[model samples]
Target chain A: MTESPRVVGRRTDVSGPGLAGAVTDLVADCAPEMDDVLVVPDCHYAFHPSTGMVTNPDVVEALVEALASTTDVTLALPDSQWVEDAPSMLGYDALADRTGVETLALGEADTVERTVRIDDERHTVTVPKPLDEQAVVAVPTLRADPDLAAAMVTVAEAATGSRERSDVVAASAVVDPEFVLLDGTYTFTGAPHKGRFLVAGTDAPAVDRAVAPVAGLKPKAVDYLRPFGVGREAIEGLHAEDLAAELPHEQTDPNGGEQPAVMGAGYRLYAKMTGDLVPPQFSGGSDD
Target chain B: MSDLRVGLLGAGNIGTVHLQSTRGIDGASVVAAADVVPDNRARAEKQGVPRTYEDYTDLLAEEDLDAAIVALPPFLHAEATVAAAEAGCHVFVEKPFARTVEEGQRMLDAAEANDVSLGVDHTIRYQPEVQTLKEQYDAGRIGHVPLASIARINNGPFAAPPARQPVSGWMLDPDATGGGALMDLGVHLFDVLEHFFGELTVEYAHVDASMDLPYEDSALVVVSTEAGTQATVSAGFFQWETPPEITGYFRLEGVADTLRSEDHLPKQFMAHAAKSALENVSKRARGQEPAYFKPTYYYQAHYRALKDFLDAVAAGEEPPVNGAAGLRMVEHVQTAYEMAEGTRAAANAGANVEVTDD
Candidate 1:
């Protein structure tokens, strides 16, 4: 029988407990059959000034150190944001300099020019898109601008020569005041796509079940992930039956916590204004 | 006094509630109950009903009754009520009267032909709070009523323990319940609205019904009367942990008095401007008291309706809450349901269906 795939997670929140560490412990306790490990920083940290993307320099150093000691390990990052600032080139240069590990850039011919300003050395390198055969380009948070969303529909229609609007998936951002940056939304119309994590196999129910708690979100908050070909119905179909016996009992509290009073008040106004018998926002979907 | 025997058609929840209500109402006795379910017969026995029959005709034929309470499901209401009317019995039926306007008309026809007193249990109309509103409006205290709103948010009937039966259960089934909250609760609100203002013409309405359920669990209906009075009724069963509460408030154009009910018991009418208006009216009419005053007792309005119906039955005169009033309520509910169902279908079809907007 084929073994379960090794999954990696990144802790997005800064103040809370590290999500990666939590995931590792939970996986060890609940899903022992799957082999997983958390990678930590070793020496040199990586930072992207433009997008505010930060990676532990020591973690990259440890990964390069591991390449010398281990041969069969596959290097993986959390998402597309990690690779925004010449990540492959920087990683390759670091590894080659430290441990003579041959760096091969494999992919189609699309040039990405970057100027690296190091101590007394300036170098420009043109790299191609990472190939599916050699290394996969994973984009965990691929948020779409509203303009891009409309453009995607136009492009999809042009490619397929069909006027069907249902054939396109749209992505958007749902920016709340508190968590403005990380809030993203996606929608898929016709079929699922690749280049993103497939939480589970063909079973939409299983995929949905594996997402929450693993992703640290309620099922309703995950609707934005639908447009990324994540199988929304599968996620929606997930019930308590699909979960493992050891999963913590869901909270029974009515209000959940001291959520923003405006959320509740706004929802009430929306209900009255729309004459909606039940407020759609409060129905556990994206109120945005 | 001779035994005032009665037969009951329908052993459903409402039927059982009626049975309990009937026990308290003097001079009425439920002799036999008939229902399609054998379990319903057991229910009757459990409720201390003397005799039970599977067929309503059997109960009508066997029981020497003064009246029959037709509490069957809505679809079966017209047939059972018409049968009771033909059998020469005063009929007390549940709200919406029948499933369709046509069916309601037929029941009315039967009652008219037999010359039997037909009273509808538009229970909300009989609600003391609603009665207070009606009394004030009729007394011209709340001068020409311009806009009224009736809002009822209850745990859908099926949310209750007794109602939480299988999917095929009577209340859950559309054919049995007739049309969800709009029919069940909306009927009552419509009756109250029509009672306050004369017959209404539904200018526009927007209804958003349930998707997963076979019937609508919620409805939002807006209607206007022929006399230019507008009203909105929002009914639903999504409330989680609250006992049902119905709030009816209307705005009068010229009247400055504010009518408020505390704990739905004592109704208070207060107004600084209307005090002079009231005093002038009271002075003009020597013996007549100022109509805009506080209610003396609790639920006096329902008691009045009950007394009126009983008085009409005793005098062989037409009952106050008649078939036509019930029919008008049913028609409004039907229109709302149709609007909701149509909107939902269009939404599913991916068509831009614009709901009625304010």
Candidate 2:
């Protein structure tokens, strides 16, 4: 196998008929050898896709359908430290129940502790037994982490092993997923920006490297992704350069909490003077 | 001086808002907070609450406070309020008062038996823009009002951006939340309409469930008051766009002209604040009690409601929005629900019948 895994990229529609096809292509390119696959997707918090905080359920549905064509795929979410009801709280349990796709709450799953070495340091971590599967697919949405280029490694870490932020890279390595699928349909760099693309490869780091530019980050700058050797190229379907050109965009906060005081005051004053309802951004549905 | 000490129950989504709203309010201080979730308790601590409890009953038993804010799920509202009342603490509960009218009555009775004030946070009527429209309507700015309408819509419970606070799963559970939009937002509309036009009779109501969800996600109701004023109210959980795109419309059509809540809203919030601040200063210089709530009325309706309740407590008077008002809103919602059930039953009955060409 190549040190820099062969990465394949394709356009995906979140709601269109093309999702199954794209997801199928990704599974075929990444985990063709495996029969039973454990798929892990980013689901840290109960955040909607519009906010770019968590993965969209549509992406997971497409993946599950695609994998069902050739493999016995079980959707998995590891119950980590922060949330107790991870499966229900993140909404994957409901999706699984709705679609009849068997889901494993990895938090409740039998866990085995193991020692792994990363960057010349040894660490002990607990990962679900499914991480030992011959084919484990690490599927994560494209979003910029304050510390990492993309949240793929962190998602793997969240589902498999340690909660310590620094141990994320080590946990991803320990999980040793055989494939990685990047759900780039909507990437949240700062705010939700549209990429409408998906990519898959055997190398998690190389896949993260490919998606780094899409989320407006340089692969070299992200320290956590350094474990995956550099110089991997993302082979695009149409234009490889177009993906990089679409990146480096800023995500603006919609809540307007951190803005300069004068600007907020001016905005509010304008609304008041004009007898206009405070801007919609400042308005929310009245819930008693 | 933080005289009226208060404790909070259920540090979930709305509880966080209640906790935050207590800050800087005169004569009120949140002394302790309780939540079933440890994470929520931690969050309350972060908000500067000194003590935390896993069970609200424990907090009520231990904390020495004048009142408790019952921001728990609706299923727990009645029981929690009763506990607060028994503990000799006035209870300010989040709306939909209870799961059933009987439960609401029990809560009211508990507060009465204990001689503790019971208030519900029906803050929609306290919104500055809505108040402005109410003022105009009261002053006959739009002539005699015949027809009025109120609507509130949002993406059921989970959509684009999840609620900022940790939303417990109970929000979607019918047993926990009573019904859906009608139970959640309908009570507020009913209360506001009743505030303006007293004693509304639900002439017609229809409800729809967007998905196979357990509860009705939408409600539409037509009502008439004793004065023969007609009003239509609708609430739905299907509002996809929030904040920037307005999802609520409150309007009154009079004989001469129509008045809308939107018209009274300040176009620029910051500009309005500056103007209000200068006006307040002028009033203070003239040795008058300035519009203390002028700045907050624009955005923080909860603060205004809480301030009024706290002031009432300090004065040993009944809260402006008391338990009776809360019960009235619940009664209105129950009637709407009953009407919807009847409609559903009739429609199903029609659907099931076999037509014979005898």
Candidate 3:
């Protein structure tokens, strides 16, 4: 039998203070050298940290602070904009200003196309040039996304070209990170709700396997996690606490399939009927 | 008494809305549409347009249009309007009117020289809740209003995850848009404010960009028509709007009572959608096309604006929102830009900026 992945996590508030000590229990388990590390936060677009739609810059700040104090690890936040300038708009510029760290705009940065095979077909994706030398860390917002673990794992793939789900999965295998940290500070279960859970581990799928139940999803239930063979009884060492039974489970879909499934038929019908250009954030009804 | 043959210049998002709105207009038919994007043109063709053009100039030259809806970008507005007017077609252009006052004036000059009607789509005041607020306030249901603020926020030219397309090239370009959210959205609020209180003056202004884009994503400007009354126009592109929920804050406060946009807004989108869908089915069965955008009042406002303009044109009367109104709104936004720059300069020179002039 293959050894289970060690996954550890903490339940903490939005407070940045002592976050390093709080998260240390899990970081030490990864046993990383913390040298020349590049941090990729799941801030693909410009969303406020408060919305829990993106990674909290405050939490990233604390993580950087703790790393600088204890280790000689050189850290950089490098990313390309998916919709808008994520670093500047998502408060990472302010994070850099406060911490004297720099954000590398990957769009302007030199890139090389990497090929990876997924579903027995080779797909090409562009990644930053510096991935060879840098130890990587991924900070993704924990939510009930369809490809939750895999999306977080391949957050830095194909900035300039077609970035479909297959390209993302194929790219995750190429730029495998040393550690994965999920910010459940406010989890988006169909929409945002306060999950207040921070999950961490070295193996992305394994961590997802262990923490899936906490977020109201089973490991086998996740298609990405299932492929990794990271299902129930997969974890060798784990510490998990979540609002699973209390908070939104699987998705924010308590209505059970009545609502439009995220840009589904209901949205398309509304857009066609109304001639609306802008996509609705949540499609049910007007609050008024 | 024949239907007006119309040509749609841009078949993108708003252009498509205008195209759809034409179905409901009494005597306007969108016969031809033009857009650089094949997808956009295809979308318009799917909406029953018989002909399509890659360049709007081709459409203006080839099609016998009575009126042209210049739904192109801000940079192309003056040129398209001028060409359409020169072609002896009345022009109904989307807002920000033109990139600058000069461009607006140039378009106005061309229209006058060609003897063509010019209409600007400023749909904010047409919103039911805003109209209701104005009606109630004028009736003294809310006594003498001391202060007011109108805000319109949306995620401009951008979307959250699951969106795979590239961001719009011209939206973030200062040269193309003339300004950012301030120009795109503030034009609507400026028009709305003038509808309530005539002859307003800018007191102070500020524009901010959270992203590294060329223009500001958020803008706040203070204005007043009378000596004591304070009104602000807060417009931004930093907001996430779901359908049925246009993120806005329309408030008018009087000595006697307070008026909020929500109090007057259309409610329960899903319920309304179901009702409208059912009604549309019946209307379709009756051998008449049903209204498509009846579910949302904001979208319906877009229809009303076009309908009002077409109705006025058909009567050979001056459109209610004419070239001059669009130019005035453009001038207001330009003043706000200048004032924002001046205010920032004053603050940088070690002088404290006051909140209000009076």
User: What is the alpha-carbon interface RMSD for each candidate?
Assistant: 22.8, 10.3, 9.2
TM-score of chain A of 3: 0.75
Clashes of each: 12, 25, 5
Expressed as tens digits, the lDDT of each residue in B53-114 for candidate 1 is 99999999887887788887777888899899999988878776888888888998998899
lDDT, residue B25, model 2: 69
Candidate 1 lDDT, tens digit per residue, A1-288?
943332222222221233233323323322322112212111111211111122222233333343334232233321221122233322434544565544442222343444433333444433332221222211121111111112222222212222132232210111000000110111111111111111212222223323443333443444423433332232222332232222233322233122235654653344333322122112222222
The lDDT values for all models are 0.47, 0.72, 0.72
How well is each residue in B1-358 modelled by candidate 3, as lDDT tens digits?
A: 8999999999987887788788778788999999999988777776678999999999988999889998888999999999999999989999989999999999999999999899999998888788888889788897888899899998787754343346766776789998899899999999888888777788889998865656888999999875356898999988665556678878988899899998876578667767876676576667666664665446777888888888888899888899999999999999999889988888899989865543
The window of 10 residues in a row where model 1 chain A has the poorest summed lDDT is A174-183
lDDT of 2 by residue, A1-288 (tens): 635567888887875578777887777766657778887877765445544456666778888887777778888886534334534655677778767788877777776777777778787767677775446777777766443424445455555544353466766776777777777777766556667788877777777777675665677776776666555356657344686577546643443233344554554454344332232222222111
Residues B311-346 of candidate 2: C-alpha lDDT, one tens digit per residue: 888889999999988998888889889877877887
| DockQ agreement of candidate 3 with the native complex | 0.19
Model 1: native contacts recovered, as a fraction = 0.00
TM-score of each: 0.49, 0.74, 0.82
Error of 2 at A267 (Å): 19
Q: Each model's DockQ?
A: 0.02, 0.08, 0.19
Model 1 residue A46 distance off true place after TM-score fit, in angstroms: 49
Evaluate fnat for each of the predicted models and list the values in order: 0.00, 0.00, 0.11
